[model samples]
Target chain A: MNRVFTWQQVAPDQWRNKISELIDSGFFYFDFLTGVDRENIDGQADCEVVAHLAKPDLSDSRIIFTQVKSELASIADLAPASSWYERECAEMYGITFTGGDTSPLLRHEGLGRPPLRKSAVLAARVLTPWPGGAEPEIREDGRKVGNVSRRRQRPPGVPENWLSP
Target chain B: MKHSFIALIEDKCTSCMLCVRECPAWCINLDSHTVEVTEEGARRPKKVNVLDSFDIDYSLCMYCGVCIDVCPFDALAWDEHRALTSTNREDMILSIADLRPSGSS
Candidate 1:
């Protein structure tokens, strides 16, 4: 059976130092770094940063997760392998990393809001025309074949405000 | 001489809406309506959805075959044939009636 590990919180101030210490202690492999948006929760940061580190033999792995209220200190400078992950998280979540490259990885400048942000709503329907042409129904000898009354459900990830139409 | 084409089994299709969701090119347009289905030797009838129309716009289709792969029921099949060609854009939109077997019509 595969075992799951819990995320350990790292203070924003000492995050870099703690990662470095883990690296020095043989946790050399940097697996991934990502962020989650938490909008419903109050008194907590809107984003959470999660990073995974492991040994070369894959015997042991550790996860470090921190609730970032604001800008987070960079560990890419210490790990080197985490540069792209940091860049992606920064681009998608709009979380800045101190002493690291804040350049966008997946998006160009001035495109829009960081898509992964909790408050970021998708593009309105008016901006993007519905690709599927007019819905079709079968008519047999001037009578409908089967009549389904309800409208189709909206696509996932569409905000509630966009459901009016 | 040989030819192949996509064979659509209209009766087997459950109208699960899987092909509509999986079609990346947005070439497929489908609709369904609910109707009563009475099983043989059964006392009561069950309400089920009957597919209204399954249309595919060949003008926009890239022939990626994603829709056929995602179908839960084996309603769509792949058949080899000459390339689809038409003189007008409107002719490229294939309706459910056009998809029926050659002799059945």
Candidate 2:
């Protein structure tokens, strides 16, 4: 399959103008917009706002991305389809969008941290005991025997100190 | 055709935990213990994993079939039989015995 990949990184201040310029040039079709958490990546933006715009016939497409510390100007006014996407980015990545409806998208109440952020800890994994920690033993008269010499195993993605006493 | 449900073949399962870790929903829970098998005239006793308990919470499962795909032992398979529905939420969790094919033991 022949495919062309085009992407550009723009400053947060020029994000709204870039989308408008792209639409006027020929890419008016709005594909989708979302936020990427770049906390783990070295020397990158805290969060990256990415949007895909394509021509009406789907011949050419461009990925417009902008790096932001925590806030980005809303492009929903220029592209109506991006309103919900902006709201989703607001709730998921904790990105504040100005000049648009940044209402709650998936969350009902205020949570501690953005769920998609790398720093957000998975509380459920820590609170519940992992079943993989079970150790085998011999049974005598329905009673377990022998001491467990193997160390307990932690589930993947869970931190070591989270399970420590 | 009826909706397929996950069936566990007890003897084939070594409880390696591949399915539990691969499950994206985090619905599968398993417990296993190690049994020391000492043979006659053997240098050292070999440790074998014994399957203690395996539970799948259907409430959280998305029926993605990821667990069956990642089972290295071929212990898990899809059965054509319809899955049971329960009124209580807690009853949705199927244990090792409940996951076995019907009419087998």
Candidate 3:
């Protein structure tokens, strides 16, 4: 059995340099890369991105995580090393990761708002300028796997069953 | 029984196809720019092309949820209430006819 281990989570800004350094040195197996949005749940989400790395060979079970804990109110532009994962976080959650590969991966033009963020007003404001209304394109079984999220999501203070579909 | 439902957000999805490339049983398909899961007898796509050749031997599925997590679009989801059935061999084999969309009933 493969032993499981968890590496410490670091602040968000240092994430890129640290990860790049690890990749440069040896650990090439980029295993896990995702972000957390603590804006409502934990207060804030900036600089809270997570990444994982390990050796390709199964010998070393150690996992390393690099986090960047920096936050920004707004962005005039983007920084490098923020790749697809980080860029997506920045665009959706309003957090920025410094470094390279800094282009938004999933965000497209004409969409008015990010859906996943814990804001009801903002989600309703989300608009798509296209003819088919606003829905990101994902296809399953050779057909569009179109879905809409959180149309009637309850606020943190409201009861879970209070909001009816 | 552990039933669950999961959906990948298309806008948030990167189309990386990691889940497509990683499924062990070849149950997932990447044709329409996203990922689709067909098991038991439920299917959302009427005529599956990319994920057409899907047949998951539920007996072999460990329910690890790796494929769901691997999806870059975050499209693959879990419906915790609907766990894999511990029935006979034929029933154990899930095809595209099992899954129906959320509001279809």
Candidate 4:
């Protein structure tokens, strides 16, 4: 069986230090992330971050999880150690890494509702004018593409947009 | 070389030492009514307390999939469902969670 260390839960603000410790332990692999419902009470945002760490050989799999309550929410970005793939995490999940920009990854023209966040409070979290301009030139693997389409044209390099409105 | 691993099923296993007997590494350990893998790194199966440890010496496993094929209760499995990093012998010792859908690399 695996072991679970339930010490004082790490607050969102403390995630920076916590991540540093994990990275130092040669546990660079940022395992998993999800919103864990830790509230058995009337109401509490006791969410948790469940992470699994493995030794370099992927052995010594250690499953250590931490809890975060609503009183102290929003983890800041961990940079340097939390770069590259880390950025992707922030943009996708609202895991505010200490140094990461609290920006939306897919703001969808920066106008419509953010499909990722389900909170009613964020009805208008999307910044106006969105990120891209009207009918911005979309790029595909370096080349510009028209728009999203369903039909597909045969052959190696045919752009799928060729069949769209 | 194909990696070979040893899986333990406590209920049907009874720690009979059959798998351990067959293993040449002497890496399997029976303790706490469970099989513990002392192996440093390799695709180790994820088991509970009934199973102490599952050590797969990646350096030695030949990927024979014998452990999976030989388990009496079909508890042992060779997870080729996902191809992982082919480098580093340590990468072979799959984490305890890696044995599941969420634990995957």
lDDT of 2 by residue, A7-94 (tens): 9999888998899999999999999999999884456569999999999988999998988888898888899999999999889889
How far residue A71's Cα lies from its native spot in candidate 3, in Å, is: 5.2
| TM-score of B-chain for each predicted structure, in order | 0.79, 0.88, 0.47, 0.46
Count the clashes in each prediction: 4, 3, 39, 30
Residue A38 alpha-carbon offset, candidate 4, angstroms: 6.4
* Model 2: colliding residue pairs: A135-B33, A136-B33, A136-B34
Work out the TM-score per prediction: 0.60, 0.78, 0.37, 0.30
lDDT per model vs. reference: 0.74, 0.83, 0.47, 0.43
Which of candidates 2 and 4 reaches a greater DockQ? 2
Cα RMSD, each candidate: 6.6, 3.7, 17.7, 22.7
Q: After superposition, how far is residue A120 of candidate 4 from its true place, in Å?
A: 7.0
Best by lDDT: 2
Report the number of the highest-TM-score candidate.
2
Better by TM-score, candidate 3 or 2:
2
Q: Which is better, 1 or 3, measured by TM-score? A: 1
Better of 1 and 2 by DockQ: 2
Q: What DockQ does each listed candidate score? A: 0.21, 0.39, 0.12, 0.01
* Residue lDDT tens for model 3, A46-164: 33455566667754533444333445221112222225555666666555544334566676754654544554233222231111122234564556666433243333323354334
Each model's iRMS: 4.5, 2.9, 12.2, 28.8
Worst 10 residues of 1 chain A by lDDT: A126-135
Best by DockQ: 2
Between prediction 2 and prediction 3, the one with superior lDDT is: 2
